[model samples]
Target: MDETRQWTAEAARAAAGKKGEETVVLDVGDLFGITDAFVITSASNVRLVRTIVEEVDRRVKAVGGPAPYRVEGTDDARWVLMDYGDFVVHVFLEEARRYYDLERLWADAPRLEWDEHDGRAVATRP
Candidate 1:
């Protein structure tokens, strides 16, 4: 995998380790120029949301991935957005994720197949 994809997988793994649900990586490079992909997941509550976010940051950095250019929505913990330039990590409360529906918004983008059991991007969607 390329560096950006490796970083994204690490972020997803970190979130999953914290019990983040429905984690998915979207290839947005063709549709969105600002970033290449998006790693999205949802937590049961505000605390879990924060935990997932922290873990993602820690694991990504531990793997030598760049720190997020900016992090938003910590105070609310409803929908946290961690912008890392090449990709963005979105950690959201279950309700917030449903309400915002990023998956549907970017339905055109191909979903990268990942191993929820091990948190690896196992294959690209055809």
Candidate 2:
């Protein structure tokens, strides 16, 4: 897998470990150059959103990744975003996920299949 997709899987696994639900990774490589992929996930509530966000941040750092270039929405924790140079991570509450509907917004982009096991992640394009 490419580096962008690999980091995306790692981020997704970390979010899943924190019980983040409806985890998804969207390949926006064709449409944008600022980043190669997006790792999106939903949490049941605000606290979980914070937890998932922190864990994902830590997981990426644990693997020697630089800190996020930018982050937003942590104050309310309703919808948090962490932007890594090659990929971005989004942790949101269910309602926010539904309302924003990023998956549908980028429906044309291919969805990447991913699985988390043994504290690691594996992924492939559909």
Question: Tens digits of per-residue lDDT for model 2 on 1-126?
Answer: 365666788789899889999898888878777787889999999999999998998988887676999999999999999999888898999999999999888777777776675333343444
> Which RMSD does model 1 reach against the true structure?
1.8
Which tens-of-lDDT digit does each residue in 38-123 have in candidate 1?
99999999999999999999999998999999999999999999999999999999999999999999988887776645535644
Q: Candidate 2 — which pairs collide?
A: none
lDDT of 1 at 33: 94
lDDT of each: 0.90, 0.84
Give candidate 1's whole-model lDDT.
0.90
Candidate 2 lDDT for residue 88:
87
TM-score of each: 0.93, 0.90
